[model samples]
Target: MTLYHFGNCVALVYVPYYLAYKHSGLSEYGAFWKCVQAGMIYMFTQLIKMMVLATFFPDNVEEFGSYLIGDFFKYTVDIADLVGLHFVLDGIPGKGHSKVLTAGIGWATAEVILSRALLLWVGARGAEFDWIYIQKCLESNILLVQHIATATLIWLRSRHNLNNNLKTVVTILLVLSCYKSLLFESLIHILKLGTWLGLVVKGAFTLAYGLFSLSIYAGMAELMGIY
Candidate 1:
């Protein structure tokens, strides 16, 4: 679990660095600060959520009224935080802005809610949810779907010749999403490896996945005319 958390943090930090380097030539300090800002936002929102969850729910077990309230509170707070960040940092369009940013946030939120609901439904069957197993196999599939959706959106945006910065932002998001998927897959596979041979196989899988993600990102960047 510690490894998983550390890997996620590393990937999140690296993503903005990569984007800044490839597109804007921002210094490491600039990229790092941006990542820090985003990290703070994420952590603050999650901390508030944890406090509320602890105070109100106190237990993982779900009662009808409590469960609904918890879910509603969690969803509302998360959405509000995300939208507030988006508006404050990115700003609403006057007349010529790609709606892709809004769409991306909406899609990501929907995906998270759907995934959690699916897990909850499965858990209600009295079966334990195997996070490692699900991350190994299912998470990649979900990420691939997201990438395809994002790529299609980028293509549509290009057809209209929207701002290059908008397309760059979308490509960066796609890369980050793919990187996260690969990182989760790596962590899960590493946890599952049993012997030297299994370790070798897991390492190979991680490398392949990483390379594939990089290729996807490079392609997306090229398509967005970032490089």
Candidate 2:
């Protein structure tokens, strides 16, 4: 679950950065470097998510399921925890934890707005913002979204036709369906290993999954001509 969460985070951050860099008219190597920087920014964001989760919702962490709402809440809490941890970990008396708590609140507000904006981008053609509809859309379309976004960005960069929307959509759905049924399901069950491995195995798998997901996006980008 953690791995899946991490992978999604990496894809979210890296894909955008890659697109931005590609569009910026940067050389291939330069764009790759910029993407690397973006990955670092994403790592910082993930750290923020972890810190916030640890500080605020420490007790409810395990209960948080692997869904869009869960991701939103987790990331929001992470941002908050980053702020609070900065001050509290510094050991500056009462001012220590104060900063983090204050930061967490601010982070939550910002993220809520940003999340809405992202959803709008993803569901721009749709008319209402029903949570249930959005959830269904996410479950059904996330893989497609990832592939199309990556492919489109690359194709545009390479001055390609960008006329393969149908193919991209179909491919994503098929891949995600298989992924959910096989790999994702198996990975979820593997979480049981946490007991014997002291949770470190789970954390490692989460990170690896995140990286692998990012690579998939990268592959899509390359195939679509963005890379």
Candidate 3:
């Protein structure tokens, strides 16, 4: 039974990534190694984030104000993800959509494997049943959407001929996406949200961002003749 449960969790977590790579036409481009390269960069970015946190933010605080200050700085470090994405986009060789999909999928896959694989291995295979593992799988799906939207926006921002107005909006959206967890944390604290409720809210947020990103991308593709 444990093995069965673990298999289900693994499928829930990973099968979408496989399906995405196969069906998104990235396979035809033979972009596998490119994605592997992006994933390696993702891991390196994470390692740097960890080292920075450990080196500079060594002390933990008990007070709420101090905690908030510390967390804000920690979240600031997440800006490195954009820098990492920039690097991922820089060297990728393909059309606009392919580059975006490759970078997004690779980055998200690396994150899920590094972050959730161990948790699923230990908890999902245990004799005890828990809804957290299931919730985590659902969360992973949302994260995948968020990452792809982020990649599209980053790629869009790179085109020098883009309208300044669109560039500004994209920059704002990128910052919002980067620090969305901080906003969600505040809302959860203020609203006293439950676990499942927070997940629902997060899904809603991801959906909104994704729709906006798609609209912007469509306009840009038409404008720039990226096809």
Q: Estimate each model's TM-score.
A: 0.32, 0.24, 0.96
| Pairs that clash in candidate 1 | none
- Which residue segments of model 3 deviate by more than 4 Å? 62-65
- Over 110-222, each residue of candidate 3 has an lDDT whose tens digit, in order, gives 99998899999999999988889989998998999999999999998998988899899999999887678989998999999998999999999999999998998998889
The C-alpha lDDT values of all candidates are: 0.43, 0.38, 0.91
Whose lDDT is greatest here? 3
The per-candidate count of clashes, in order, stands at 0, 13, 0
Measured by TM-score, how close is model 3 to the native structure? 0.96
Error of 3 at 72 (Å): 0.7
Most accurate candidate by TM-score: 3
Tens digits of per-residue lDDT for model 2, 166-187: 4464345433422332444355
On the 0 to 100 scale, the lDDT of residue 109 in model 2 is: 28
What candidate 1 gets wrong by more than 4 Å, as runs, is 1-30, 65-74, 87-227
- Candidates, ranked, lDDT: 3, 1, 2
RMSD of 2: 19.7
